[model samples]
Target: PRAAAAEHADQLFAGLQDPALYRFIAEAPPTDVEALRARYTRLATRRSPDGRQAWLNWAIWSFAEEAYVGYVQATVEAGEADIAYVVFQDYWGRGYARKAVAEMMGLLREAHGVAGFRATVDTRNHRSRALLEALGFECVAIHADAEVIHGRSPTRPSIG
Candidate 1:
């Protein structure tokens, strides 16, 4: 639950390179470590205030496995944030994504005063859609290719 750093690039790249994990992601995973390192370097810089977007990222580590598993992130703008997450294929179906996202929401709410969140999921990604729904996010709109889901912290009143 810390900010991403350059040292994490190799493990992150290794976990993300599984093609099965990229099915619904916008871009394919980097083909090599150097490409991943470059991407991570840019991500690290975005933590600065001068960066155009407020990007919060965390590398997920499993204590039992003693390894980095994946990541969860939020792109913030104004009162709301867009959230996304990824877990290595080997760790799929273990409830890790759900737990991580729930924890992330708490951190965002407490630290950044973000009361609401939105997530866009490909229509075919049933697992992700279910995860969001389970976390109290409701599908607000459905485009031809994707669905937009919104959630409010249970401790906060809903916003229209």
Candidate 2:
């Protein structure tokens, strides 16, 4: 079962191909069942340390967008204290993304003492940019390939 989940993770992100999304599960080698088991068990049983570091992936509801309809992934990085996410293609143009992002920000602020966060979105990803804006993130910088967005938590964010 653990092997299967690991395989599924690899297969799932392989299809998406965004490095940000893939980074969450890319190191898992499906053929290494023992390693997969260890990793899977840890993720399955671990609790967020009051939100200092958290990773989540959830399915978006059907009937809102594309056939893949609903899926969301988020991570609050430890050092830089950035939050990032990506949604499935079919789920575009829906409000699910904004809602999920806002919620993740809440989790980061309430549970992790996160004061600020950053994100890098592909330059052409207007949908993602809009979602970030709706969540109160500010467009801070534009890289050659990506636009950077930042949000401040209600309280002072942790440096760690």
Candidate 3:
């Protein structure tokens, strides 16, 4: 399922606080902690009309602090799942996202009994595309105008 801009905004702001930090990859301006918290709480506790969760999201905190630097949002598709992620600006340019993604993939493979994972990257997002490729994902194709690069993760070798 697709998420609302407000929900994504709330999470993006909360994950990357400082004005200087928020400017890196976000499309919106920075937000104060209070506004960020309120919106986050609302979105976090929000339930669908059917009484089910709004959307599934997960976070990876920064060390022992409540502060977070990485998180993932996934949607179920054809009995499988597709994931997307964002890392804080302070942590950008580092290999943290790659490391975190690798760990998440391992956990998902075990817990979900999944055979593969997939991601779509903007053509201009070289860094993200590279990270995906480094994780064993191959570019499957480019969507119209090459705006999106679809890639898939390989299945782990089976053990005897």
Per-model CA lDDT versus the true structure: 0.83, 0.53, 0.57
> Tens-digit lDDT track for model 1 on 1-160?
5677777888788788788987887879888888877777777875546654578888888888888888999987776889999989999888878888888888888888887899999999999998888888999999987999999567633222
Tens digit per residue, CA lDDT, model 3, 101-147: 67666655665554566676767677888787777777777875333
Please give, for residues 29-146, the per-residue lDDT of candidate 2 as tens digits: 2344455445444544334657555554443344533233334444555633565555554444555566666665666577666677787777776777766666667888987867
Q: Rank the candidates by lDDT, best first.
A: 1, 3, 2
* Poorly placed runs, candidate 1 (over 4 Å): 47-52, 156-160
TM-score of each: 0.90, 0.56, 0.61
Clashing pairs in 3: none
lDDT computed for candidate 2:
0.53
Clashes of 1: 0
1 or 3, which is superior by TM-score?
Answer: 1
lDDT value for model 3: 0.57
Give the true-structure RMSD of model 2.
Answer: 7.9
In model 3, state the lDDT of residue 25. 42
Clashes of 2: 4
Better of 1 and 2 by lDDT: 1
